[model samples]
Target chain A: MPRYALLVEYDGAPFVGWQRQASGLSVQQVLEDAGASLNGGVPAPTMASGRTDAGVHAEGQVVQIDIALGLSPERLRDALNFHGRPHPVSVVKAAHAPAGWSARFSCTGRGYRYRILNRRARPALQAGRVWHVQGPLDAEVMHRAAQHLLGRHDFSAFRAAACQAKDALRTLDRLDVERQDDEILVRTEARSFLHHQVRNMVGTLVQVGLGRRPVEWPRQLLDGRDRTLAGQNAPAEGLTFLFARYPEGLDWR
Target chain B: MPRYALLVEYDGAPFVGWQRQASGLSVQQVLEDAGASLNGGVPAPTMASGRTDAGVHAEGQVVQIDIALGLSPERLRDALNFHGRPHPVSVVKAAHAPAGWSARFSCTGRGYRYRILNRRARPALQAGRVWHVQGPLDAEVMHRAAQHLLGRHDFSAFRAAACQAKDALRTLDRLDVERQDDEILVRTEARSFLHHQVRNMVGTLVQVGLGRRPVEWPRQLLDGRDRTLAGQNAPAEGLTFLFARYPEGLDWR
Candidate 1:
C-alpha cells in the first residue's frame, strides 16, 4: 500500500472536530470516506496529528493514510476535494511520506492561533472567523502574562474535565499575543497538550487583558493546579490548528 | 433632526448593493428600516459615500442619515446593530457630524481593495470572500502595469456599460499591487469611480499578472479609450470598499 500525507484545511463551523464519532460528521470521516471512494470502495484508515474539538478550524493539519489506489499525489488531493464537496473540508496538498513515518509521531511541534475581535461593536467582516470581545483589551498585558506559561509545567488546571490524556505534563514552545487594529491574535506552539489547554489558557489571559486579573494570575493558577481558578473556556470557533511541524529530514509538500 | 455619520461594515453576499432595489434587499434599505423603527415609524433618509455592487464587501463604509429620534451616538449605533440582526450588516461607530456634511459629497477620497486567492486549489477558509485564480500570478508585473492607470486619465475603457457618470475623466490617487503567500491584493484610491471601473481594471491587470498580456498592455488599453480592449470585468465578490476619507475638520468616529 502507498502512504500519502495530506495537508488539510477546513472551516470547522459544521464539523464535530477532527476525530470521527457516532454522533456527527468529523474531518477524519470526511477524508476517509473520500479516500474509500478513490480506492475502489475499500475503506482506508486516516490518522491526524491531533484531535480538535467541535467548531475548531484548521489551516495546516497533517493527516496520513494508507490506500491501495495507484493515484498520484496531486490526483489524490483533487479527488478527495471533489468527493468532499459542499463540506468546507479541503485537502490543500499531498505528498508521499516514508514507509514508517506517522503523521502524529513524526510531528515535533503543533501550532495553533486564537483570534479575538476586540471592539465596542460585534464583529461584522470577521463574524465566524474570530472571537468577539467587547470593550478594550490590552494585548501587551496578555503577551506578558503568556510568557509565564512557557516551558515544562503541569497543566492540570487547564485540562478539560473529559480529557483522556494519561499525563498532564507538557512542554509549551511558543506563546505570543499581538494586536492589530481591532483584532488580537494569540499564537501558540507545543510538542503536545492535554485537551482544552489552549482555550483555557487564552481565556485566563484575556482576563489579564481586561484588567480584571493581574499579570501574576496565570502563574498562580499554574501553581495552584486548580481548574476553578481559570477563566472562561473561550469559544471553539476562535481557535485554528495552524500547522504540524515535522522533523527536518521528512519532506512535506 | 439629528444628523449622524456612521462607519459601517458589512458582508455583501446577501445584499443587492447599497441602494434599495425593487427585487431584493439592500444595505441602505436595512439601515433606513432600522432607523424608522427607532423613530416612531418615520422614514429616515440615509446617504452613503459610495454604492457597492451586490456581493462586494466593505470594511469601512461611510453613511450619513437624518432622524427625528433623540438618541446619543452610542445608543443609535447599538439600536441599529440590534435591529439589523439576522443580517450581516453592522454599524461599527456613530458620531455627530456638521449640520451640512454629506457622506457622499463631503468625502475627499475613497479606497477599495480587490483580493485574489492565487493557488492551484480552491480556497476553503476564504471561499466566497476572494476571487480564486489557479496557477501563478506575477504581482510585480501587475503592479508595474497598474502605474499606467494612475493619475488623471480618461477611464472610458474601464467604465461599465450602464455607468451613469457624465464624464469618463477621473483622478486616481493611488493604485498598488502586492502579493503575500498565495494571495494577491490590489488596493486603489480616488475621489470617486465610475461603475465597475475598479473590477474591469483589475481583470485587465490579472491578464498581465498571468503572463498572458505584456506589462505595457494596460497603457495601450488606456490609450485606446475603448472598453472592448480591456479584459473581463472581475467578479464582484473580490472587491471591498475600504474607506471614505473626509476633510480634516469633520470628526469621523
Candidate 2:
C-alpha cells in the first residue's frame, strides 16, 4: 500500500469535527467515503495532525491515508476532488509520503488563530467566522497579559473540565495577540495542546482585554491549575487550525 | 431638520437589494425601520450612493437621511446600530452632511469586488460569499483582458439589456484581476456603472480565462455596442460594493 499525505482545507460549520461519530457528519467520514470510492473494498483510515472540534475551520489541515490504488499523485488528487464534489472539503495538495511518515507524529508545530470582532454591531458576513465582542478592548494590555503564559506550564486552568489529556503541563512556543481595525487576532503555536486549551486561553485573555482582569491574571490561572479560575470558554466558531508542520525534507505537494 | 450621512455595511444574503420593494426585504427597509424606531415616527426616506442588487454585499455603502433628532454624530451611529441589532445591517460611521449633500449625487467613485473560488468543492461557510467555479482558469489572461477594458469606454456590450442608464458610455478608473490559491478576485472602480455591467464583464472575462475567447475579447466587446455580444451574467452572490469615495474635506466622517 502507498501512503500519501493530503493537504486539506474545509469550512467546519456543517461538520461534527474531524473525527467520525454516530450523531453527525465529520471530516473523517467524508474523506474515508471518498477513499472507499477511490479504492474499492480497501478501508482507508485517514489520520490527521489534530482532531479539531465542531465549528472549527481549517485552511491547512494535514492528513495521511493509505491506499492500494496505482494512480499517480495528480490523478489521485483530481479523482478524490471529483468524488468529493458538493462537499465543502477540498484536498488542496496530494503527494506520496515516505514510508512510516504520519501526519500526527511527524509534525514539529501546530498553529491556531482565534478571531475576535470588537464592534458595537454584530457581524454581517463575518458572523460565524469571528467572535463578536461589543466593548472597547485594551489590546496593549491583553498583549502584555498574554506574554506571561508563553513558556511551559501546567495549563489545567485553561484546559476544559472534560479534557482527557493525562498531562496538564506543556510548552507553548508562542502566543501573540494583535489587533487589526475593529478585529483582534490571536495566534498560538505549540507541538500539541490539551483539549480546549486554546479556547480557554482566549476566553481568559478576553477578560483582560475587557479590563475585567489584571495583566498577570493569565499567569495566575496557570499557576493555580484550577479550571474554575478561568473565564468562559470561547466559542468554537472563532478558532481555525492554521497549519501542521513536518520535517524539512518531507514532500507536501 | 438635521441631515446625516451614514456609512453602512451589510450582508446582502437576506435582502432583495438596497431599494425597498413590495416583495422582499431590502437594506433601505431595514435602515428605515431602525430610523423609525429612533425617531418615534415614520422614518424619513433614505438615499444611497448605489442601489446594489439581490445577494450583493456592501462594506462601505453610503446613505443619507433627514430627521429632527438632535443627536450627535456618534449618538446617531450608536442609536441606529442599537435599533438595527440582529439585522445584518450595521452603521459603521455617521456624521452630519451638508444640507445640500445627497448620497447618490455627491459620490465621486464606487468600488466593487467579485470573489470566485476556483476549486472542485462547493463552499460551506463561504457558500454565499463566493462563486464556486469548478474548473481551471488562466488568471493571467483574465488580467490582460481586464486591463484592456480599463479607462473610459462605451460599455453597452457589458450592460444588461434592461439597464436604465440612458448613456452607455462611462469612465472606468480601474479593473484589476488577481488569483490567490484557489480563489480569484476581480476588483473594479468607477464613478458610476450601468446595470449588471460588472457581472457581465466578469462573465466575459471568465470566458477569456477559460481560453474560450482571446485575451483581447473584452476590449473587442467594449468597442462593440451590442449587449448580445457579451457573455452571460455572473451570479449576484459573489459581487460586493466595496466603497464610495467623496471629495476631500467633505467631512462625512
Candidate 3:
C-alpha cells in the first residue's frame, strides 16, 4: 500500500467531528468514501493529526491515508474532490509520505484560531463561522491574561472531564489575542492538547476581557487545578484547526 | 410619522434582493414586517440607497423608513432587530432623518466590493461568498488593466440591456484591484451605476488577469460602446454593497 499525506479543509457544521462513528457523518467517512471510489470499493484507512470536535472547522488539517491505487499527488486530490462534490470538504494538497511517517506522531506542533464577532447585533455576513458575543470585550485585557498560560503547566482545570489523556501536563507554545474591527481573534499553538483545553482557556480569558475576572485569573485557575473553578468551554463553531507543523525537509505538496 | 435612517447589513442568500416584488421574500418586505410588528398593524414603507439584485450581499446598506412609532434611535434599532430574528438581516444603527431626506436620492456616493477566490481546490469555508476561479491570475496585471475604466465615460458596453437609465454618461469615482493571499478583491465607488455595471467590469478584468484579453481591452470595450463586445456579467453572490456615503453633517448613529 502507498501512503499519502493530504492537506484537507472543511466547514464542520455538517460533520460529527473528524472521527468516524456509527451515528452520523464525519470528515473521516467522507474522505474514506472518496478514496474507496478509486480503490475498488475498499475503504482507505486514515489517521489525522488531531480529532476536532463537532462544528469545528479546519483550514489545514493533515491526514495520512493508505490505499492500493497508485496515482500522482495532483490526480489524487482532483479525484477525491470530484467524488466529494456537494459536501463542504476539499483536499487542498496531497503528497507522498515516507514509509514510517505517521500523520499523528510525526507532527511537532499544531495551531488553531478562535473567532468571536463582538458586536451588539447578531452576525449577518459571518453567521456560523464565528461566535457572537453581545457585550463589549476588552481584547487587551484578554491578551494580557492569556500570557499567563504560555509556559508549561498542569492544565487540569481546563481539560474536559472525559479527557482520555493520562497526563495533565503539557507545554503551550503560544497564546495571543487581538481585536480587528468587531471581531476578536484568539490564536494559539501547542505540541498536543488535552480535550477542550483551548476553548476552556478562551472562555476564561473572555471573563477577564469582560471585567468579571482579574488579569491573574488564568494563573489562579492553573494553581487551583479544579475544573469547576474554570469558565465553561467555548462553543465549537468558533474554533478552526489552522495547521500541523511538521519537521523540516518534509514535502507538504 | 417619524423618519429614520438605518445602516443595515445582511447575508442576502435567502432574500430575493433588496426591493419588494410580487413574488418571493425581499429585504424590504422583511423590514416592513418588522416595523409593522412595532406599529399598530400597518407596514412601514422603506426605501434603500440601491436596489441590489438577488443573492447580492451588503455590509453597510443605507435605508430610510417612515413609521408611526416615536421610539429613540437606540430603542428603534433594538426593536427592529428583535422582530427580525431568524433572518440574516440586521440594522446596525439608526438615526433621525430630516423630513426631506431620501435614501435613494442621497446626496453622495456608493461603494461596492467583489471577492474572487483564486485557488485550485473548491472553496469549503467560502462556498457561496466568493467567485471561485481555478486558473491562475496575475493581480498586478489586473490592477494595471482596471485603471482604464476610471474617470467619466459612456459606459454602454458594461450596461445591461434592461438598464433603464436614460443616459449612458456617468462619472466613475474609483476602481481598484488588489490581491490578498489567494483572494482577489475589486473595489469600486461611484455616484450611480447602470444595471450590472460592476459585475460586467469585473468579468472583463478577470479575462485580462487570465491572459485571455489584452491590457487595453477595457479601453477598447469602453470606446466601442457595445454591450455584446464586453465579457459576461459576474455572479451576484460575489458582489457586496459596501457603503452609501452621505454628507458629513448627517448623524448615522
Candidate 4:
C-alpha cells in the first residue's frame, strides 16, 4: 500500500464537519467513499491532520491515506474531485508522503484564520463565511491583547469544556490581528490546539476590541487558567483551517 | 412626493438582473415589491445608476425612488432592508440627492471590478462569485495590455452585439490589473460603458494573459472597431459594479 498526502479545501456550510458522523454528511466520508469507489470498493479510511467543527471552513487541510490500488497523484486528485461534484469540497493537491508518515502524527504546526466583517452593513458577498460584527471593533487594541497569548501555557481558560485533550498545556507560536479595510483578520499558528481553542481566543479578543475588556484581560485569563472565567467561543463560521506543516523528510506538498 | 437615494450592494446570484423582465424575476422587481409593501402598498419605481445582467454583483450601486409617504433616510434604509429579508440585496447607505438629481443622470463616474481565481483548483470559497481560470495567467502581461484600453476609444470591438448605446465612443479613465495571491483583480473606471464592455475587455485581456494574443492585441481590436475582432465575453459572475460617483454637494453619504 502506498500512502499519499492530500491538501483539501472546502466551504464548511454544507458539511457536518471534517469527521464522519451518524447524524449528517462529512468531508471525510465523502472523500473515503469517493476513494472506495475509485479503488473498486476496498475500504479507504482517511486520517486528517485535524478536524474542524460544523460550519468551519478550510483552505489547506492535510489528510493521509494508504490505498491498496495505486494511482498517480494528479489522477487521484482529479478522481476524488470529480466524484465530489457539486459538493463544496475539493482536493487541491496530492503528493506521496514518506512511508509511515501520518498526517496527524507527522504534523509539526497548524495555522488557522478567522474572518470578522466589522462594519455596520451586513455582508452581501461573504454572508455566511464571516462573523458579522455590527459594532466598530478596535483591531489595534485586539492585536495588543492577542500578543499575550503567545508561547506555551495552560490554556484552560480558552479550552472547551468538552475538550478531550489530556492536558491543558500547549505551545502557541503566534497570534496576529490585522484590519484589512472592513475585515478583521485573526491568524494563529501553533503546534496544536485544544477543542474550540481558536474560536475561544477570538471570542475573548472580540471583547477587548469592543472595549468591554482591558488590553491585559487575555493575559490575566491565561494566568488564571480557569475555564469559567473566559469568554464565549466565536461562531464556527468565521474560522478556517489554513494549513498543517510537516517535518522536513515528510515530502509535504 | 419625497425621493430618496440608496447606496445598494448585493450578490446577484438570486435575481434575473437589475431590470424587471417578463422572462423572470429581477432585482428591480424585488426592490419595488419590498418598497411597495413598506410604503402602504404604493408602487415605488427605482431608477438605478445602471442595470446589471443576471449573476452580476454590485457593491455600490445607486438607486433613487419616490414615495408618496415621507420617510427619513434612516427609516427608509431600515424599512427597505427589513422588507428585503432573506434576499442577498442590501441598502447599505441612504441619502437625499439634490431635488432634481436622478440616480442615472447625476452619475459622473462608474467603476467596475472583475475577479479571476487564477489557480489550478476550482474556487471552493468564491464559487459563483469568481471566474475560475485553471491555466496560469500572467497579470503583468494583462496589465500591459490593459494600458492600451485607457483614456478613450470607440469600443465597438468590446461591445455586445445587442448593445443599444447611441455611440461606441466612450472615455475610459482607468484600467488596472493586479494579482493578489491566487486571485487576479481587474479594475476599470469610466463615465459610462457599452453593454458587456467590461466582460468583453476582460476576456480579451485573458487571451493576452495566456500568451494566446499579443500585448498590443487590444489596441489593434480598438483600431479595427469590429465586434467580431475581440475575444468572447467573460462570464457575468466575475464582474461587480464597484461604485457610482456623483457631483458635489448632493449628500452622498
Interface RMSD of 2: 2.7
What is the lDDT of every predicted structure here? 0.90, 0.87, 0.91, 0.89
Least well predicted 10-residue stretch by lDDT in candidate 2 chain B: B244-253
Tens digits of per-residue lDDT for model 2 on A84-200? 766788887788887788889888899999999998766777877899898988888888899899888889999988899889989999889999998999999999999999999
TM-score of each: 0.97, 0.91, 0.98, 0.94
Question: Over 4 Å off in model 3, which ranges?
Answer: none
- Root mean square deviation (Cα) for candidate 4: 2.0
Task: After the best TM-score superposition of candidate 4, give how far the Cα of residue A246 lies from its true spot, in angstroms.
Answer: 1.9
| All candidates: DockQ | 0.72, 0.47, 0.78, 0.61
Off by over 4 Å in 2: A39-44, A67-70, A75-85, A248-253, B41-44, B67-70, B82-85, B120-125, B134-136, B248-253
Clashing pairs in 1: none
lDDT of 4 by residue, A5-32 (tens): 9999999999899999999999998888
lDDT string, candidate 2, B1-253, tens digits:
7888988999999999999999998999888888886576887679999999999999889998776777888888888878777788988888888758888998999999999988765565577898888789889889988998888889999998888998988999888899998889999999999999999999999999989999988899889788999988999999999999887434644
**Span of ten consecutive residues with least summed lDDT in model 4 chain A:** A244-253
Q: Write the per-residue lDDT of candidate 1 for residues B1-253, one digit (tens) a residue.
A: 8899999999999999999999799999989988898778976889999999999999999999888888888889998988888688899999897868999999989999999999876788888899988869999999999998889999999999999999999999888999999899999999999999999999999999999999999889988989888999999999999999988544545
Candidate 1 residue-wise lDDT, A99-164, digit = tens:
788998998899999999998777777888899999699999999999999999999889999999
Worst 10 residues of 1 chain A by lDDT: A244-253
